[model samples]
Target: MAPEQGTGSRSGCGGKGRGRGKHLPGACWDTLWGDHSPPHFPSGQVVKLELLEQVQAQLRDVLDKAMEEAAQSYLQPHRKDPPTQHPSPPHSSGLLEVEHFRTFYHIFIAMLCVFILSTVAVDVINQGSLDLDFDLFIFAFGCLPTVLATWLVMFLYTLLVPYKALQLWAGSYHTVRFPRLFTAILLEALLACHAAVLGYYPIYTVIQHQLPAASRFIVILKQVSFLMKSHSFLLEAVPGIIHAKPPDGEMKLPALSTYLYFLFSPATDQLPSPRTPYVRWKYVAQNFAKFLGCLFYSYFILECLCIPVFTNMSKQPFSIKTLVLSIFNATLPGTFLLLLSFFAFLQCWLNAFAEMLRFADRTFYKDWWNSTSFATYYRTWNVVVHDWLCYYVYQDLFWLFRGRSRVAAMLSVFIMSAIVHEYVITLCFGFFYPVNCSPSLPSSEVSAGIQVCLYCQEWYAQIHCPLEQKTFWGLVTPRSWSCRS
Candidate 1:
C-alpha cells in the first residue's frame, strides 16, 4: 500500500492493525467515501477528506475578507470625501420666506419710527425741544468690557486645557493596560477643573456682584455655550485619536487652526474638516446686514412691547382679570421675542459666519413655523444645538444601554436639556424662578402632553377662524398665550 493509504487505514482502524478487529465504524467510513467511491474503497475516503479540508479553508478566507470589508466601510463612511451638503429650501433672496416675516419687519420699522416720533413729540409737548438720548441702549449693554474679558478667559481655557489633556490621554492609551479606565478618570478630573473655573466662578460672579441683566446674560450664555462646545470637541476628537492607526505608528493631534475653526463655526459638533465652498463677499455682506437688522428688530420689540406692558403689569395689584390681561399682553411680545431669537441666532447670525467661512451647509433652521407637531418643532427649531445633544448625549446613552432602553435614553436627554436650560436661566437672572415647568417635571409624558395641548389649541383656532382672521392673528397674535397656564 502507498504511504497515504497506509496512514488512512491506521487512522480508520484506531491506530492499530485490522487483525485486532478494532476498526472504525462503517458509518464514519461511509461518510468519508460514500458520495463518489465504491463501498469497499479506502483510498477514496482519503481523497474526499482532503477535498473537504480545502473547501473549509476557502470558506474561512472568504468570511474573514467579508468581515474586514464590513468593518472598513463602517469605520470610514466618509472616507476622505467631502461632506454632503443639504441646501436650504428654495429662496428668491436666500432667506426663508416664512409667512408674516416681511409684514412683521415693516411693522417693526414703523413702530421704531413711531417710537422716535413719539419721544420727540412728548419732548416738544413738555420740554419744548427734541432731546434725543441713547441712555437706554447704553444701559442695556452695560459692563461690556467686563463681559468680554470674562468671555476671553473662558475661551482661552477651553481652547487650550481640555484639548491638551485629551491629547495626553489619547497618546498614552495604546501602550497602557486598563487604558479605558485610566483615560476616563483623567477626563473626569479635567472636567472637574473646568467646572470649577469656567462654570461655577462665572455664575458666582454674576450673583455676587449683582451684574446687570444684559451683562449677566452675556456671561451666563457664553459660559453655557463654551462648556457645551468644549464638551463636544473632546467627545468628538478624542475618540478619533484613540482609535487611529497612523502609518508612522504615532498619533497626531488635530491642528490648532482646525480646532479654532470648530470653536467659531456655527456648528456645535466638531468635524475633521467642514466643506468650504468659494466665498461670495456679497452673500457674506448680505447675511451680516440681516443679522444687524434682526438685532435692531429685537431691540424695538423689547422697547415697544415687553417693557411697557410687563412694567405696568408688575406695578398693579394681582387679580384674575389683571393676570389674564397681563398674559394676553405678554403673549405678543413673548412670541415676537421667540421668533426674533430664532431668526437672529439660528438663521442670520449662523448664516453670516457660515458664508464668511465658505461653509456650505446652510440648512440651519428648517421651516419650523410650519411644523404641526412639537417633536418636529424641537428638531427643526435650532438644529445646531439639537444635533450636538442627539449625537453626544442621546446616542451615547442609547449605546451604553446596548439599545435596549430607547425610552430611558430619550427621557435622560430631555432631563439633561431641561436642567441645563434651567441652570442657565437661574444663573443669569440670579433667582430660583423655574419659568419652564416642563424641565422641572420628571415625566416626559407630562411634557409631551403639554406640547400636545398647545398644538391642539392652535389647530382648533386655525380651523375655526376664517382665512382673513387667521392671517391677522398669524401676524399679530402670540403663541405664548397657550402656555400661560
Candidate 2:
C-alpha cells in the first residue's frame, strides 16, 4: 500500500513538471521549483534588494519634488516680490546691485555742480556776465507737439487694429477650414498698412523735408520703436490666442487696460496680466528730477567735452593726423555719452513713467558696464528690448529650424538688431550712411570679433595708461588712434 501511494505522488509531481516545461524552459522551471538545497538568500542579496527598493523610493520622491518646482518656476517667469525703497546690503546683494552706484552717484552730482560753476565762470570770463546757452537743449525738443500728434495716431492704430484682428482670427480659426491662411493674409495686410502710414511716411517726411537732427531723431526713433512694439504685441499675443482652446461660445479680446499698460511699459513683450505697484507721488517726483538731471548731464557733456573737440576737428584739414586726433578726443565723451544714454533712458526715464503708472517691474537694464564681452554687453545693455528679441525673434527662429541651426538663428537676430539700429541712425541723421554696417555685414562674425578686439584694446588702454598719458597719446598724437576704421 505504501509503495502504491509513493508511485502516485511521483506521477503527480512528474505531470506538474511537464506542464511547467511547456510554458517555460527546463532551467527556468528548475530554478523556480526544482529539487535543490533548502532555499536560502545570502545576506548580501537581502541587503542589495532592500537598498534597491530604498533607492527607487528616493528617486520617486526626488522626481516628484523636481516636477513641482519646475511647474512653479514655469508659472512665474518674472519675480513676484514688490519693489523696495532700501538698497540691499552690500554683502547680501547679488552680483549686480543698485547700491553699487552710490559712489558714482555722488561723483556725478559733484561733476554736475562743477560743470554748472564752470559754465557760469566761463560766461562771466568771456562775456563779463552770466549768459547761459540753453538754446541747443531747447532746440533738441522743439518738435514736441508734432511728436505728440504723431504718437497719438500710432497709438490709435496699434490699440484698435491688432487686438480686433486677433479676436476675429481666434473666433474663426477652429470652425473655419482655411482659417490660418485667411488670418495670415489679413494680418499681413494690416501690417502693410501700418508700415506705410506709420513707418514709411514718417521716414519719407523726415528725409524729404530735411528735418533738423533732433527733430528727425524724435520722429524716426519713435516711429521705429512704436512699430517694433506693435509688431511684438501682435506677434506674441496672436499665436497664443490661435493655439489656445476656445472658451464655450463667444470670442473675447484682452482687457483694454492690459493693452494700454503694454504700450507704456518698458517691456516689449505683452503680458495678459502685469504687476501693478502702488503709485507713490514722491517716487515719481524723484524719478522725474533724476531724469531732468540726466538730461542736464548729457547737455553738459555735449557742450563741454564734445562740442569743442568736434568743432575744432571739423575746421582742421581731413588727414590721418586730424582723424587720429579726433578719435582720441572722442574717447572720453564717447564713454560718457554711452553711460549717460544708458542711465537716462533705462533708469531715469523708464522709472519716471513706471512710477507714474504704478508699473512694478523696474529692471529695464542690467549692469552692462561690468560685461567683459560684446555678446554679454548686448544681452545686458537693454533688457526690455533683449527680452523681446530673444523670445520673439531668436527663439522663434530656433523653433522654425527645429533647434538645429543655432548659429543661423543667432545671426538672424543680430542682423535684425543691426538693421533697426542702422535705420535709427540713418533716418535720424537724414543720410543713407550705414553707421552700423560693419556689425550688419554678411561676414558679421568677423566684424564682431574685430569689435571685441577693439573694445578690449580700448578697455586695456583706459585702465593701464594714466589719464595724462591717455590724453597726450589719444588727444595729441596723430599715430595713437583708437576708433574702429
Best by the TM-score measure: 2
User: Which regions of candidate 2 deviate over 4 angstroms?
Assistant: 1-99, 175-177, 244-251, 271-277, 432-485
Model 1 RMSD vs true structure: 15.9
Q: Tens-digit lDDT track for model 2 on 314-374?
A: 4433457654555566656566666666777777777767767656666676767676666
- Residue-level lDDT tens digits of model 1 in 1-485: 22125554445435332221113345444545555544343665656655654664577578879998999898975646433653442221244455577786777667667766776787899999876565656776777877788888888988888878877887777767898798879978997989887878787777777677668888988787788888888877776776777555667677778778877877777744346545556766877787777666666666665556554444443356755565555555556556666767777777778767767666676667676665676687777778888988999999999999999998898778778876776565443334454432222333433332233233333333324444544534523332232
Whole-model alpha-carbon lDDT for candidate 1: 0.64
User: How much lDDT does each candidate structure score?
Assistant: 0.64, 0.64
- Each candidate's number of clashing pairs is 0, 0
For each candidate in turn, give its C-alpha RMSD to the true structure in angstroms.
Answer: 15.9, 13.5
For each candidate in turn, the TM-score is 0.66, 0.69
